[model samples]
Target chain A: MAEITLDQIIQPENMVYTRSRIMTDTVLHYCPGCGHGTVHRLLAEVIEELDLQSETIGITPVGCSVLMYNYMDIDMQEAAHGRAPALATAIKRLMSEKFVFTYQGDGDLAAIGTAETIHACNRGENITILFINNGIYGMTGGQMAPTTLPDMKASTCPYGRDVQMMGNPLKITDIVATLPGSYYVTRQSVHTPGNVRKAKKAIRKAVEYQKRNQGTCFVEIVSNCNSGWKMTPVDANQWLEENMLPFYPLGDLKVPEE
Target chain B: MGELRLMKGNEAVAEAAIRAGADGYFGYPITPQSEVMEYLMAEKPHERTGMVVLQAESELAAINMVYGGAACGKKVMTSSSSPGISLMQEGISYIAGAELPCLLVNVVRGGPGLGTIQPAQSDYFQSVKGGGHGDYRLITLAPASVQEMSDFVRLGFELAFKYRNPAMILSDGAIGQMMEKVELFDPVPRSKEILPWATTGKTPDRERNIITSLDLDPKRQEDFNLKLQKKYREIEEKEVRFEKIQCDDAEYLFVAYGTSSRVVQKAVQLARSRGIRVGLFRPITLWPFPSKEIFAMTEQVKGILSVEMSAGQMVEDIRLAVKGKIKVDYYGRMGGIIPTPDEVVEMLEKKIIGG
Candidate 1:
């Protein structure tokens, strides 16, 4: 085999990217094998494929992905913890021309902002919501999230998340789907390449529906947090698939039949 | 010119807000001010002009919703009574900290805590003194009549965007619920020239913008506060608004605003009839305090008698303007009780004339 040169790898002509990177090329500080990188890539791919980078506005919630704006090339509004839905509601209402989406964690969506989320969805706002369900608060160092699995270990749940004491993991997508105005609701994972591709499709569809002015599209991406889970990235993915999926089943809960 | 219609003060505000190109209105229903929301709901400005109108769960949610729309660079607003406006202070402070331009209307009511729903001016201090926490101030306008109530909607939006700060229309329950004939300007499509700097989301040509009030560094917060104070000072110099009645040569001038100003108007007429040489100093802009005009009048007048439906609120500002050069006395009736023009004239005659 011929020896490879740095010039060949860095050449502009050889670039295989047909889609523009709406997400910045900054080196993400996520731990190795962290599912955030995969999730971010999928979202960026959807934005690129849909060509929605220019018209899109992302409302970032207070969580690990709070600074997701730094990486997303589109305009971003940082919202108070759990208030992403409220922010998105106002933004979409006022600037109806722009495509608005909210990126929230389980804790932000189900805990403090439950009322805001429920009402926004019920109102059938024309906006997309990307919810990352990791089952723990990664930003504040692994506290128990509203979506934390029963008997799962977290800093706040040192004795493991006991359902009897802490209540069951909230299934927000299903609950949201029950609202008449919620046109599309789905849960997907990104552990493997096939799953990652499916998640990108779901996210792209959600954005497309929002552009069409469909009411309240929600896409939940089940992800892994290695640091929060106290596991390696590879191990975290496996633990999530085996333990998390059973409790939080993935698939389309609501969709407009075409 | 739009078609002229007879309307209440609250109804006019709601109609004018839609005409002024406000994109969103988030409000809660309260006594004496419920007509504002009721008018919006009936007219359905959302369907006609693409405006969004929501009766929020509470005053707190309504204001926060305004905060959200303003962050997106949209012209948004909310109206509430004293108790409700008090609930909105935190969000108001956040809006100010973010330097967002939006309209807030307070239909004044007697209150320390839900004191009474009847018309009162007790919210004077709260509106002009920066009701929320933090070192910031809102541009406040006091409309004494139904006409001014309608007029301030456009003026509040203009000033809010000009100063990149929240602007308030402080009316009382009587004005808010009072009905009168109003002539409003024709509907104007939202002018892009007004707010070119509003956050329109991520465009390929510009960097991402973040609107927030969180400054962890104390020094940075101090610097921000100083900048805000400087802006307020400039507003005092340029944007102060007031009305003068018979102050060219007068011994006693009654200083008041909002609902109290209307009573003072009648009292001035009564004093003039009695040959007491009483004039009225009504501040249209309460935050800037109309100090310049009050000072100008003080050069000729003997003293100022502040009349309000509160214990004593505008009196403090009158004192600051007069600066002990002229005696300043206050007359007020609290907790939903309004002092009539006769009562104010009597007080002036007793305190400044003989008593």
Candidate 2:
């Protein structure tokens, strides 16, 4: 077979190509059929549509998406484990004109960083938070997370999450919505094309609120960890609807009164 | 350029910070130093000079807020007492390790536990030596009076930004609570000085900036530490400062800092009245310790008295400087009890003039 030239191999039309300066060109290390790919794509498309690449600053937390900055083409700051909110607080306050956002996982946000996230939201800082709740610690070999549903089995919870021993799944959106500074709080799932579209809207609204300097806006994307859950992408989405959605029902928790 | 105003040391610090062109103040209220936060709140520097004043929930969050502001290349400050300052040591170490410039003030009260709300100089080692878990040192300045307490804001900020290091103004309950007359000076605006290293953002004309302290490699951290040590050496040589009173022909030298210095000054006067040749060496920069100055006095004075608010803290430094060249005596009062001038004079008579 003849070796294909670089130009011939490139097809911009068939690929997802847009103006998001936040995502880098580095090859993603995420497993095939992982929901992170879908979520990252949706966010990148929204960022491209909004034309916020230059003014956007992404914060990467410690988790499966720890290297999320590597795929984004924009300026990125890596936070200490579970400290994205604190770092974002600094970045946004210092550069108020810049659009700042944090991409965190359930373990990083709901568990180790509970206080940081709560206080940051309570303080009413102006920034967007994109929380990925996968119900388990993916990068750290699938330990249970604060968002792990009851009866969900993981490396740490082989007998399934016992509410008696472990705590109940944290309802972050509901808790954060109670804070007066929260201009927008919504939870979305990315198991279906329709749900992915809805997740995109929630993310877009969050970014928009940040743009308007309204206040803290958070979007929780209930994603699937295919490898950690020990299922194919299709099966994971189906499992999500049957198991996770009932517990973590997705919808807007708060919005402008108007 | 004005008349002296009588004010509490905490209020003077707040006023001086505002005049020092500080754009941000993030602090929590703790006794003996609550006035610093209250003054900033009531005065509302944000309304006049565009300063950002925030009352953080805890000293932990407040210091982190200062860290964030400093990371932005803005002049920020935080004030706390001994217990609160203890909680800030981790963030301070991070700031120093990252080489971010900011100001911190410690209005000390008694402490080992939640010791007391009264005056104490027990944090001498904590301030001069590294309090946090690291091999780093912060530039520590000890103010002996309310006037110097206010004046320290200017010097602390100047040294902080100049060296890209954290500068600390270590005072105590007395200095923070007592009233004194001070002639304040306006701070030179930061815009007047050019700081190319500040992390504003990536400009079209320059390279992208990253403010971080993550060094995964051992060799690289060693190099960074070496550079820090060299910078510290330069600061030791150039910034070490102290006050010397009547030491030209003295038989005894009283070495002290902060509130202890005032006690020594009073004792020196009393000694002179009794026809005794006693002098005082007061260190303004606690970390630098005025070693050369104190070392020079070894030839003039028969013995050095280390008078402090704690149980022989600064005496270690006095002994180190004297290096057995002269006899060293210690006088102290612990647990928030300040040694009176008479107590120091008596120690001098028993330890030096009589011995």
Candidate 3:
């Protein structure tokens, strides 16, 4: 090893990646190894790459990412619980030239906000919806969410999610894909590097569809909640691959034909 | 000069909104106020002034849409009846907490559940005393006529933006449904300047504007609340509006607002004809409540009568204003019943004058 030193590896010509300028210097409030940080990074990168840093506006939901505006260096609005889609609809309609999107969690998008979610997509609102389905309400102390897997234990479902009693785990993305207003619908995770790349691509495509004024584009990130699941980050990734992937499946559920 | 046209109160609200340079109207149909959206849709304000009119899926969605539009610093409004306004309380609270400016028109009907569709003033407490969660108050304007209905639309937006708080036109079905001569004003051109505080977009020249109501830290939330309260106090000191008719040397005062004020005006004339020496104190801004003016009247009047179309909701505010200095009595009709002027006179005579 002839001293191929740190300076050479860190040179601009050799630099492979850097933090997106679309993200502010504020430290993320999410816990260590949380998937929200990865998702936020991917969104920042996609927004920066699309050159939407100035014209893009984001609506954040009432969850852990409620303070997402602090970290994202873009104009943002915080919607009431489950009302992000409704807000996004108004924003897009009022300023059709602007790029608007909503970042929502499972409990926010699938449960309390189901009516707004389906109707926004059904009406073909020209906006993007970034849904994070972590199978539990991560912010409000790991309660059972609408997407909580059957037999998956949550704080509210300590005895495990009984399918018969709690009803089947809702696949809201699938339900939303069937709506005619939705032009593109896909589900991906950010657990692995490959998955992160795919999720970033999906985000870019959704933004592109929004720019074209196609219709509502919904991208669901089936992520993991390590603390909520009471597992280490690595164990949670393994559990997600074995469990969430089978239920949520990684692929495009709907896409418009060219 | 704009046209002086015969229009219903709700229709005037829509037209005035168009002429006032409102940028958007997102509303759901609710009885007694559905004409607001119906008239907007029919008039196509979008074609004329570039105003966006949308019939939302529900009152909940409509209010949130108003929140979004307001966050962008666009003048937006929504109209609903009692039940629908109740559904919008959560969004209204959020708007208040975020300190976004928008107009809300509540053509109140009887309530306490799926109440009647007919006009009533039962939503007084809900509108003025913070209907939604948290300590917040709407700068509530009570429009007593079709002209006031039109006038308040512009005034509501002005006061809303001035304080960066929500303002409401608290009318009733009686005003919303009744036709009257309204002198519409010339269309004010929409502002071309971007609001510095609004979340339009983040340019490289400045930091991003975030419209949010959440402050996870208790101390920060308390500070926000204190700031809101201080703003409310300033509004109370500066924005108390009322019409004091014949109150200089009056023996009895009838405190009423909206349609009840119109009817009470007739009753005051009837009482004067009967040599009862009665005056009318009509509060134009209900949230500012005209408490100082009401307190001043207490020193001059022998008694106060709070007349409304609801079951004594505003009477509490009147009593608080009087502070037990004078005998404050309430006379109201419940379940969407509109009392006649003669009936109001009779109640005044029996409750305040005779007693």
Candidate 4:
């Protein structure tokens, strides 16, 4: 067989895919098969597709992806725990021409930073909020979060979450969708190739809303935490589909009226 | 001076921020400092200069907003009273640690816990001694009059940007609420140049800028801390500001600042009338405090009395400054009580002269 030359294989017609140009060469710190790496790539792809790589300012929450800037070649600010929305609020307000978005986890958005989250959405700030709900506090060793499923066992709820004591898991995205300030609210996942494509489309749409000054765009990605879930990556996806989706079903919660 | 008007100290701060070309002002309403936001809203600088003025839901949100604004290389500020300032300590610490430049004004009321709405200087220790959870220093300015309140807004931004650290105006309820004549400086047009260190979206020309305080690596964190300390040391050497009144012929000294300094001036007058040779020394910068200058006064004075609205917070710094070479005594009223000129003189005569 003839040798496949590097130049020949790299031809545009032969190139099936390439990593997003906005993503840096830095190594990701996520565990193998973790959904964070996938979602990050999706966001990078969206930024590149819209040619906003130089005009986007990202706000990262104080969770596992606190170092999101390390992987993204974009101007970024690391916000305090649950304070990403507050930071995004100011950044978007101060620089209305730039695209600003916050990446927050379930604990940050639904638990510690409830007030910041709710108010930013209610104010209808022109920004995007990307929420990743893994049900448990992944960075803090699996502590149960406000979005932890009922009866789910976590580090803090080792005996399983008792409905009487821990109360019901919060449906924060639904609550956010109800806020008039939010121009678009959607929920998607990246556990599979099909899901990844949908999630990317959702992110691009959210960024479009921000560009139009249409108010806050909240996109919640129900993701997996194999390490925090104490399951293998394959089993975690299976478990998420069978268990997590039943409580936090995925789809657009709110859409712009035609 | 471009404009002359009668204004409350808090109002002066707001007006100065706009005139100084501040990029944003985020704050929540609190007594003794509510006028800061009220005045900003009324002026609508957003319409005039494109500056953002947001009334945040809480002090916590306001300060964090300041962090974000500062991270973007914008001139940002927030004002609050004692309890509100306490709620903002966490955000302030993060800003300090992140090396972001911003301004803060604490129009202080009395408080261990929501003590009173009246003036007090009890936050002296909290302001100077790293109130939040880290070993960082805030460049603190003590504004004495409505003019200084207006003036420090610009000066604070200069110092904050010069060091890439947070600067605070340590004020009190009396100064914040009292109305007096203020000469405002002409507006400084906001600059369009993008700072190299700011987190204002990356261009194809530069490496992306990041605004963060977290350093998981121990060695790098220590180096940053050392760098911060070095900056503070330089500030202490270069920015010590103090005003000495009649100290050339003084035998006794009355040391004070902020609202207390205003009263101590009259007390100095009263003491001199009684043929007591006493002068006043007012510290303008509280963190890069007038320590060396106060120590210099020990050679020309016999005894020193420190007057404040707090029980004795600033006096300890005075003791550290004088280094026990002279007798440094403290006298003040607390729980939002203002000291009278006569009572201050009596304490001076008793605490230092007699003791």
Q: After superposition, how far is residue A135 of candidate 1 from its true place, in Å?
A: 3.4
Q: Which stretches of model 1 miss by more than 4 angstroms?
A: A1-20, A25-38, A138-144, A149-169, A191-194, A224-239, B1-4, B46-48, B192-196, B214-225, B272-275, B349-355
Q: What does the lDDT read for residue B315 in candidate 2?
A: 88
lDDT of 3 by residue, B189-262 (tens): 87766999988888989989999999889999999999999999999999989998887779999999999999
TM-score for each prediction? 0.88, 0.88, 0.98, 0.98
What is the lDDT ranking, best to worst? Answer: 3, 4, 1, 2
Per-residue lDDT value at B79 in model 1: 96
lDDT of 1 at A118: 82
Write candidate 2's Cα lDDT for B149-255 as tens digits: 88999899989988889999999999999999999886555443424554454444644454556665799999999998998898998899888988887888898
Candidate 1 local distance difference test against the native: 0.85
Q: Mind giving the per-residue lDDT tens digits that candidate 4 earns over B1-355?
A: 4789999999999999999899999999999899999999999998889899999989999999999999999999999999999999999999999999999999999989978999999999999998898999999999999999999999999999998989999999999999999999999888687899998889989989998999999999999999989999999999878788888899999999999999999999999999999999999999898988999999999999999999799999999999999999999999999999999999998999999
Poorest lDDT segment (10 consecutive residues) of candidate 3 chain B: B185-194
Better of 1 and 4 by DockQ: 4
Better of 2 and 4 by lDDT: 4
Model 4: lDDT equals 0.93
Tell me which residue pairs clash in candidate 1. Answer: A75-B202, A151-A161
> What's the distance in Å from true for residue A184, model 4?
0.5
For DockQ, candidate 1 versus 3, the one ahead is 3
Interface RMSD against the true structure, candidate 2? 3.0
Clashing pairs in 3: none
